[model samples]
Target chain A: MSLPLSELPTDTVAKVVTLEVGQDYRRRMAGLGLRPGVAIRVIRRSPLKGPLQVRVGHTDIILRRSDAVRIRVEPMPQTRGVPADAAHPEVVPAP
Target chain B: MKRIALLGMPNTGKSTFFNRLTGAGARVGNWPGLTVELLSARILLAGQMVEVVDLPGIYNLHGFSEDEQVVRRFLESQPLNLLVLVLNASQLDRQLALALQARHLGVPLLLLLNMEDEAQRLGIRIDSAALERALGVPVRLLSAKYGQHYREALAAIERSLKAHPALRRADRRALEEDQHIEQALDRLVQASVHAPVQLPPTLSERIDALLLHPWLGLPFLLLILFVLFQAVYALGSPLQDGMEVLLGEFRRSVLDPALAGLPSGLRSFLAEGLYDGVGTVLTFMPVIALFFVALAIIEDSGYLARIAFLVDAIMQRLGLDGRAFVMQLMGFGCNVPAVMGTRIMRSRGLRALTMLVIPFSLCSARLQVLLFITTAVFAPTTAPLVLLTFYVLSVLLAMFTAFIWRGRYVNREPLLMELPPYRLPTLRFLLHEGWRATLQFLRGAGGYIVLGVVVVWFLTHYPFDAPPASPATLAGRLANGLAPIFSPLGLDSLLAIALLFGLVAKEVVIGALAVIYSAGPDQLPGVLAQRLDAIQAMSFLLFILIYTPCVSTIAVIRKESGDWRLTLLAVAWPLTLAWLVSFAFYQTARALGY
Candidate 1:
């Protein structure tokens, strides 16, 4: 299922579908290796709605939650065994 | 002279490479814009003198950010002999995309794979020969920090310049397509790079788990700040005292006796005006140096970016980027560096807003005067409370100012900063950074400080032939003219004049007060108590806390912002705020029968 990147559970890998934002933001993110079709791992998220830490290739970047919400991502099919915590995702997708 | 420009993605160790190539100490922080302006140094390479320009880091030539525009404009205007593209070997996937984009810029290029040691540690290796063949440029793998493979890079640069390689501009439309760039990066990475399939959890990730934790991160940040303040005080105070004593003794024993042969007016001018004015600024060098050393270590270790990540939400609410919080922390040490430190902020609006709020950070100079007043005017038990209140007010005022200024324009920049892997800060790098910051501070702000002191000295000393010139001079006359304006805050002519002299530098206020009252430092408290009641004293302290920044700070603000209107606002806003706040405090205290 495709969702905003901010809704992706920590440790889940996903491919960027698109950045549903302004051209400038998309360009800036693209320069940082956040281009569409590129896979990224949601490594961590701050507890109080802070920035999300996403690993893109070998580089780790912090994105504000607001910006993260604008980035569309589709979950990658699990290649390794699915972790039990994946069953109970922490983030609820924005309605 | 032929020109070569260093270009790369942010945090790719471009400045470090620039420092190595030019043997210049260009500022290199983990964050961006340490080289905000174009910095060029003349170097003799292989018997040819070439000007090497360190351009601000840019993600792509077509990028819209200010730094990218700077790079774009320079590339368009300057006739370059060679373009050196620096890349982080550990993150070659993204960095190479920038390299590919720059190659299309039609500049003759030499690609440098910097930070090869980190790449090696990560079990990532790049075949530079393969990459060079693929990109059609000479490529060298180097660790600029360790000076690895620099000679080969320089030789290649010389060769590239001599050969005058053909320039081919990349298709602008092709460069604009995101998917096209990504596919090209994938192709380049697959052809030339090798890495372990499953990397271990890195040290940086492990540290970030704790440092960026929601519950623990804020407290950790506070603890770091607490420790930094303690370190600055505990380490800096003894050195400050020692320098103070040494300079005082030299003035009394050597300088005064040597200058006794001159006319008394000239002697006083040389001793008090020139020496003492500059000496006051010099005495704070140890503290300023200590602050920068600690800041450098924090920045180099990559924790500063984490702090920015941690505080982005809170700072955003105040209409500032998270980076402004770091600048505010630096302001507590001294606002001059804090103002210059705003160069790191990429947005002009953010820089201006951060600079505006920084003056309220209770810098060391203002703290000294507040410390003096609190200890003198209040009881022992209440002194600490008063001092704490002043600090709290400083922060509150800064936030309030930011609150008013936050929505002036809608800031569209997202917080998309790279979290660089942590590395231990080398002592040599730390000391060099500290020394360079201190020298920059002195070189930029020292002249204004000296001028201010000499001007004040002349104002107080003019009509020198008059005996017992004591506060009856032109400065005194001017102070008397302005006294009624401050009378509501319980300031007499002497207190008013001392504050006027404080425009030179805040630290001189206490000394100016001492001179005005014709009392020794030890007798200051008694004279102060005799002149004013506790309420009035409190009002005066409040005024000192919020008044206009010192002359040096204004000079730096002007230099950094390049805006006289903003500099005028910097002076006018604080002065107005100081008066309104002090007046309110004094009136409220009197109405409440304090």
Candidate 2:
């Protein structure tokens, strides 16, 4: 099941489905290694609707929660041998 | 000389590599755009002179941001022999996208995996040979921070130079290029990058958990600022005082006695115009230096990026990204560097807006004048509160200016900045960076300050031998002509003249006041108290607080913005605000019979 990336709870593992934002935001996210097939782990979100910290590949990026909400993601199924927080099993349905 | 450009994403140790190769101390903050402009330095490698240009960091060549545009324009304009693609070893998966893009540009490329030491600490091991073979480029593992692997980098450059790799231009209209690059990066990383096990939360992560805590973060930021200001005052004031006394003594005992043989007019001109003017600005050197040192430490440690993250929400409301807040904070120390600091912002409009608001940040020179006035005018019990009020007013005015100017520049890119891992800044690096910044500040603004001082001196002393302190000289005549306009704001002729002289610098206001009133430095407060009542004094202080920025700041704004209209607005807006605010303040106080 897919939802807005911002809706994922902290420490949840998700695969980016597709970005629903403008072309500019999409290109920027892509430049930062966040593409449709990339696996991202929601690290933490600031309180009071602040930015969300997400790990894309080995890079951690802080994104505004609004921008994060525009990114569609599907949670990866929990599997053995994969850490609870790490986003493994990159297979997910495209948005 | 053949030109080789150092290209990388922001904060990937590209400038560090540049400094290593050229021995040129280009500013290297952990934050981006420290080297905003292209900096070229000559280095002799293998008996051949090579000009290495350190281009501003850009996320992608295709991005239309200021830095990206600058990099793209330079590549298209300049004939370059080689491009040095500097990548953060630990961040290769993401950084490789830029390298791949650059590679497609068909420039002869040497891959520099900088920060190899940090990658090792993170358990990130890259097989450089395998990567080089995979990408068909010479790759060298380098720890630029530690000055390691210089020979390897040079050898790679030499090898690439001899091979004469063909340049292939990528189609600008190819929209799917980035996706192809990303896939290529994935393949390269899977083949050559190795991390044995998933690493636990590192020290930076653990610390960010607290430092970036939503509830605690704001307080942490405030506490850091409070401590910074306290240190600047505690450590800087005594040195400032000592220098003031030293300069005074030097003038009286050495300069005055030595110049006795010269004509009195020339002697006075030298003593007042040149000596005292420059001396006034020089006395604040310790304070400015301390501020830069502290700022460098915070910037180098990577906490400044966290500060940006913390303030992003509030800054967004002002139509600026969070990084602009750091520039504003720097303004509290000095406006010139703070104005230049706006280069870090990717949006041109955001940079201009930030520059417009920075002059109201209550820089150290202005703060000194405010502190002097408050303590002298108000009773001790009320002085601190008055000073606090002025500081609060400064911030409010700055925000108001930001709000007013927000609509003028609307197109801004989203705030997507990388938060580099925190590291302890070495003392040597900190001092070197700090000293270089201090020297740059002096070089950029020093001549203007000196020129301002000389002009003020000339105006105050012309019509020679006419009772030096009398209100009949050129400065006095100018002040009298302008006094009527300021009469409603409670500024008399003497105060008006002092304010006119203060255009050179805020610190000179007190000095000018002393000279105009014929009072010694120690006697300034008594003289001020006798001349003006509480309401008038407060009005004067308010006017000084909001008035035009000093000559140096105006020059920097003009230089940075490169628009005379914006520079004029920077000056005129503040003067109008100061006059109107002071007028309303004095009238209200009088009506209340204070």
Candidate 3:
């Protein structure tokens, strides 16, 4: 569903459908590899209602929750598979 | 020996790579030319020797900030044989911009994908070979955190050096925002990568709820700062006290006895001047080191960026971006680094603004004032309250100074900063940083402290060589001259003379006093304990805290601002404010019958 990023819940994991940042900020985000189709895991809900710590690839970024709402994503069942001692379930190591 | 420069965005494990490469430790250094300081290390990699200059991290090579200039200048000079472009794998796009800029420099570049493990953990996949093809450089994907990629990166560099022997420089125009190059990078990233990444649905809604709540965020920021200060003071005090006593005892037993056989003038000068002044100040090294260690740990763990986010708006009001707050916090430990940290402030005006307000951060030298007054003036119970007031006042002074600078030179741009994640700070890293700070303090005390003590002793002891009214007492005369200037502030004593001696090094004031006011152990109790009264003591504390930062800090300001006008402004403004504040407090205390 298309909702602002700020509406995300504490335990939710989501894929970034799109980033609705300004041109300057967009250029910066693009440079950081935060493309439209990147999956990000929310590590922390801001205590000050400021930003969410989303884990994308190997880095965790704090993006304003309002920014997150524009990106659309679908929910998947929380996998309980031995979690692979992995941080991101979707990532495959270099073969 | 081939020359190499390590370049990356802030928080990319470039430092870890340096440690892994050279086995040399990371410590702060004065970046050549600029007063701005950054981490640097000289390491011998492989059999053939090369110096790896760790360049300051920046988002873009095209910026006016001293940090950006530092990189640009190094690139322009063609000083290095090879440029090691370290990229945070987790944040590739932004890092690539810098790498692209490096490519434009046309220097032989080896791109190392640092933090690959963390990147994998975050569900991002990268094809190193693909990226290597795209950038026309060797790309080694390994975790600097675990030292996984060192061998591959090193081997690649060694191989490249053997084959090429000389590096090629890229044309500057090639890096100048060419759409063709940008499109090529995009195409390369898409073709070689096999990840259609998406944000998780649940986490999105959760963040939406918290960060968007206007009412909750600001208070949370305030609470975080409160807790941080409390932690700094609570955790640091006992360690600070222990060091103080140890240094005091060492002086009394070892240093003091060594000087006893000398004439009373020589004895007092050596015992009190060198040992007491610089010694007492250096003893607080433990606390200062603890503070810096805590700060570095927070920054490394990535939580410090959040602090920047939370306070960005307030900081912007001071003609500074929120980044300056981080620098100011650095100022709490030492203004030298804090002024240097101002390099992170993007705008020149904002950087200057940060530099100007930095001296207000109540550095370690001011800690002596805090300790002395809190103990001497108020009842032991009121010590905490006094300490709290001083901290609060320092912050208020910072805010007030920001307001003044904003009115004079306002930059109305809103702050946009990257907030890094909340990871637990690693113990190994924290201890390493802490040890460096502690050692610097010890070395500083050993070198500058001893020398400063000797100078003060010479100033106060030789020439006239008498007590109370000795002609050899330049320190006494200077104090007497400066004392009246402070009379309105209600602090005029030998302690005042010590404060003048303090201009050399704040700690020297203590040493000067130990010699200037020498009653035997029976007469003089807990150091300055017997000399100054509560009201005057508090005034003395207030004066030191606010007056001047120090000579090193001033020199750094002169270097960073480049204009002597700004440097003078940095010094004069703080001195005036300090005097006014101390006067007000002293009068208010006297009115209350303290």
RMSD of each: 4.5, 3.7, 7.2
lDDT of 1: 0.78
On residues B281-334, what C-alpha lDDT tens digit does candidate 3 reach at each position?
565566656666666765776556766566544554466655677778757766
What tens digits encode model 2's per-residue C-alpha lDDT throughout B1-594? 666778898888887777667763453222232324456677776567776788888777777667777777667656667888998998886787787677667677889999998888878889988987888888899888787887788788887766663433333443224445655767777788886447556898889888888789889888987787678668877898899999999999999999999987899889988997678568757766776677777777888778767887778888876667877876887786678666556677888899888999998888888888888888999998888999999999999998988999663778676678897876666666557656665665566667877887788788778755358888888888897788998888888888877787788889888888889999999888888888898999999989999877886677666678888899999999999999999999988888
Predictions in order: lDDT: 0.78, 0.77, 0.63
Q: Which rank order by DockQ, best down to worst?
A: 2, 1, 3
Query: Which DockQ values do the candidates obtain, in the order shown?
Result: 0.41, 0.53, 0.16
Candidate 1 TM-score, C-alpha based: 0.91
- Model 1 fnat? 0.64
Model 1 C-alpha lDDT per residue in residues A1-46, reported as the tens digit of each score? 6999999888877777777887777777767777777677787787
In terms of lDDT, the poorest run of 10 residues in model 2 chain A is A80-89
Model with the higher TM-score, candidate 1 or 3: 1
Q: Can you write out model 3's per-residue Cα lDDT over A1-95, one digit (the tens) per residue?
A: 64454565544555455566555555545444455544445555644444555555534556555566554543334722211112243322211
Residue B85 error, candidate 3, Å: 2.2
